[model samples]
Target: MTVAVFDHEGPWTEEEYLALGETSQRVELFDGSLHVTPAPTPRHQRISRKLGNILETAAESVGLELLEAVNVRLRPGRVPVPDLVVTAPVDLDDPYIEAADVRLVCEIISPGNAATDNVLKMHYYAAAGIEWYLLVEQTTGTLRLYQKRGRHYVEHQAVKRGGVLNLSAPVRATIHPEDLVP
Candidate 1:
């Protein structure tokens, strides 16, 4: 008889993942294994860049700071690099990004990451207690907003192209989907 063994309790350190370096590779260390994703397509980059800029601008108006694709080590071996993250002001020597300090997290969904972003990532973000998460789908040109509710996030709204996405209170900006994609 054969029994399966899994590294369920992983206190995997950061150094292991960093060694792989940047090759347009998107990888998350889960249970001591590397879950790697391919480089995002051009359309993905456009939406991500636009969303980052828009969020940064809006956050600035409210006296907040935003970080782009910064590593937020949610747990020991579960680190997923979000497209953009908004956090409170950090000291120059702040070590790691944690879920507690994050105000918002946005992910630009690509054809390859639709299932992971919409399903897998959604659960992870909710489990980490991220306040807000926005998903921008490039193919559909749609923006979906989710706000933390109890232990999960309920879809706040789905904004289509040309529609305005109103920023949550304190951060005021109405962004049109077309403005983000093109």
Candidate 2:
């Protein structure tokens, strides 16, 4: 089910990328290239929901909003849909959330697209100046939090199942890795 719809013959424009995303499948544009990922597995959805709930509670305390699977425009030619994000109030009329407005971006690694979440997207989010990034490794049931330092992300916390992850930068919340794996 995971597939790439376009050949790397030419770079795609932001308009073109947005058009392609109109299809039923989920697609992300990174460095002018299109990457299509399969629908999330049940485990992926469950983990996302659990993390969203935890983030939601923290966001409520901080007066931010929690969004799931929303299109984030990191830049002109880069749009990555993060699994979950915490941001300031968004205007419904806007087409996509801007990177500057994002407080934290969370990606729950899909088995088929681990590299995209672990490496590519991490770099992109950092380059876009997103303050915080959370990566949940589905296979290992581990949670890794990264804070933007300079132009890249330096690992802040790495917690395995049964371990606790405490966040204080973007928001104040304590999450257990065991709660993230269903």
Candidate 3:
């Protein structure tokens, strides 16, 4: 079941909302509207899995931890679940993810949401002070990286499938396109 509350405006407190479990359900709260994305297609799942695996291996070697499809509460009223998130080492008692602690957030473009992923989500992450945002598209197997530049994001890199994903301010890891495509 999907729950949406629009009457009580303003962002919800992090502790009150982030208590949800990390299940298969993709949950997001956008612009006062709560949206639950449908279960990803098999193709989407394949890419998510492969990307997660590659990131996991890279993160493990570096003392960083990677999270998959987890609710990253940017603010009270804005929470987006990225395809993958790279974060600093979690404190023992803090299980929730906040924007300030995130090193990088990545979203894989799904049909009908490419514009939102590349534009709206880009604005949101940048405004929230997220240092790096990665947008990966399945259509062309392209990965776009954006670095925050004073309340906006400037195009950092756009790499095709065979190209490597280079990121600074988080961890240095190169992502091969074959690792993401099935």
Largest TM-score belongs to which candidate?
2
Which residue pairs clash in candidate 3? 11-76, 11-77, 12-76
- What candidate 1 gets wrong by more than 4 Å, as runs, is 1-13, 19-23, 91-95
lDDT by residue (tens digit), candidate 2, 72-140: 999998999999999988885676899999999999988888888888899889999999999999889
TM-score of 3: 0.82
Model 3 over residues 1-182: C-alpha lDDT tens digits?
95553334555454444555454567677755656567788878888888777777777778888888777768777888888888877763554578887888888899877887888888888888999888878878888888888889898999996788766557767787767866
Strongest candidate by lDDT = 2
Over 1-182, each residue of candidate 1 has an lDDT whose tens digit, in order, gives: 95423233454556767555564666676546666677777778887787778778889887778887666667766778888888877663554587787788888888866898898888888888887888988887889889989989998878998788897743666879998887
> Which pairs of residues collide in model 1?
none
lDDT of 3 at 39: 75
Scored against the true structure, residue 182 in model 3 reaches a CA lDDT of 63
- For model 1, give the 10-residue run with minimal summed lDDT: 3-12
- In angstroms, the error of model 3 at 75 is 1.3
What is the TM-score (0 to 1) of candidate 2?
Answer: 0.91
Ten residues in a row with the worst lDDT in model 2? 2-11
- Model 2 regions more than 4 Å off: 1-9
